[model samples]
Target: MNRLRILLADDHPVVLAGIRALVEAEPDMEVIATAADGTAAFDLADRLRPDVAVLDMSMPGPNGAEVAERIARYCAQCRVVMLTVHEDRAYVRRLLEVGVAGYVLKRSAPAELVRAIRAVAAGGLHLDPAVAALAICRDPPRPAAPEAAAEPTEREAEVLRLTAAGHGNKAIAQALGIAVKTVEAHKANGMGKLGFRSRVELVRYAASRGWLGSLQP
Candidate 1:
């Protein structure tokens, strides 16, 4: 079997070492590279195009959300999983709105990180369980009270959810077990149906409809 390629990004050397150790300990996984900041993370990821990028949420330059977006645009096959200490639902919500794959809290155990990586690599979403619960219960009113009903097909909804979670066309296709062209079709159809002309609007629509909750991240 091919080893899972991984890229680590964190400003702290100690944390970076810990993550490298955790990932390298897994026989099926390999640490391909490490970046000390978000900019370098983006550069290395664009160059190496690892299977997954374990990024710090509060990194310098673009931050996690922006980095995830860049990865989706430039390295569509590579998935991004945020590793951070933040439990802020809004922050998580915002990142998911941009289609990020996983969100693991820094407090989570190393095993949990491994679990998250595997889950996402398998085309499933994985949120830190605590974060999921908090997001679900903390502010029920936010997602529960959608102002409009932007009708979308089942496949379109799926595309929207995955897109909002930061999966690119190729990743979405893999996750949905469909062709990349089909993923693009669904994304286009969904956006057209929602009357959304931009990814930002699509994200807002998905967030209002609570589609982000249904994703793994």
Candidate 2:
């Protein structure tokens, strides 16, 4: 079996050690490298090309969002998972925009971090429940204008909600008892109706409507 390669980055020594231990304890994951600052993290990620890079939101030199952006540009194959104490929607939006695949709160259980790494490694997005709630509270609904496209049908909405919750097409199909092609169609139609061109935009839209509130950890 191939174990998941992981790179960890954080400014706090104790937190770094704790995260390393937590990740190492998982049988299917291994920490290939660690950095105490954002610059080192980016360098390690670019060099090692780990399956996932777990980053702290605030670090010396460049910060997590900047590092994530750099990695997204320079190391497209390596996914990023942000471990942060912030539940701010602005931080979440910025990180997501920069291609950070997962956002797990530092205060969340250790298992949450492990789950986040696994999720992003498998090409899925993961957001902490608390941070997701911020979107619901902050983004008010906008009244649709007459020129806007019609709203998505029930099936499309259901598929989109599941997509926002980080389930890929196959997984969504399995869960909803539909064909994978059907799942894709619903997702495409839903995103088109909402004028969203990317998964990040779909996630933010879902969060705004409290559709992602059901996501746990």
Candidate 3:
């Protein structure tokens, strides 16, 4: 039986050990390698090519964000999960833009980290809900296509609402009793029709439309 192999990186020794223990305790996950800085993390990742790399975002040298960027480009097969104390919307959005598959705050429970590692290893986006709830972000403006940006179908709205509320695609799929692909397609179509570029933007849009029940300003 194949288990999920992980490369863990953090500058702090105690934090590194704690996270390593948490991951090792899980039956399905194993920590294959560990690194103390971003440069070492990048080097270890290149050598190990683990299923997932949980990187501390503020590590020294190249830094976790830079390491994530490199891993995404050079080790496309290995998923990058940014483990950080940063819950800033800008930082989270920037990490996602750089292709990190998961963004988890250090203050969050250890179980959340496990969930994020598993989710990204299986090719899914995983975000901490507290960070995700701060949905406003700035992006370069694109020309609005009003025709293409028409009102979404009922199903699309449903998907967008759940998505805005911080539900992963798989979770939304299960809730709606639809395939994950279907959930993704609806989300894409809805975002296209609404001129939304990111999940946070989609959440704000959904809130504006009253599709999401209580996510307010």
Clashes per prediction? 7, 0, 0
Instruction: For candidate 2, report its TM-score.
Output: 0.72
Q: Between the candidate structures 1 and 2, which one is better when assessed by lDDT? A: 2
lDDT of 3 by residue, 1-217 (tens): 6899999999999999999999999999899999999999999888888989999998989988899888866776678888888877789767765667678888998898998888777655677767755543244334346777478899998887766544556657777899989998998998898777776566446555665443233
Which model scores highest in lDDT?
A: 2
Question: Worst lDDT window (10 residues) for model 2?
Answer: 136-145
- Flag regions of model 2 displaced more than 4 Å: 136-193, 196-200, 205-217
Give the deviation of candidate 3 from the true structure as CA RMSD: 6.9
Instruction: Estimate, for each residue in 1-217, the C-alpha lDDT of model 2 and write its tens digit.
Output: 8999999999999999999999999999999999999999999998998989999999999999999888877776677889998887888877776777789998999888887888777766777777865643355444444455689999999998766654556657777899989998998888778877666667767766767543442
The sequence of per-residue lDDT tens digits that candidate 1 reaches over residues 89-199 is 777777665656788999988788998888777655667887775544444332322433666789889887777655788877877899989988988877766666555
Comparing 2 with 3 on lDDT, the higher-scoring candidate is 2
TM-score of each: 0.75, 0.72, 0.68
Q: Candidate 1 clashing pairs?
A: 99-164, 99-165, 99-166, 100-165, 100-166, 125-216, 126-216
- Looking at model 3, residue 58 earns an lDDT score of 89
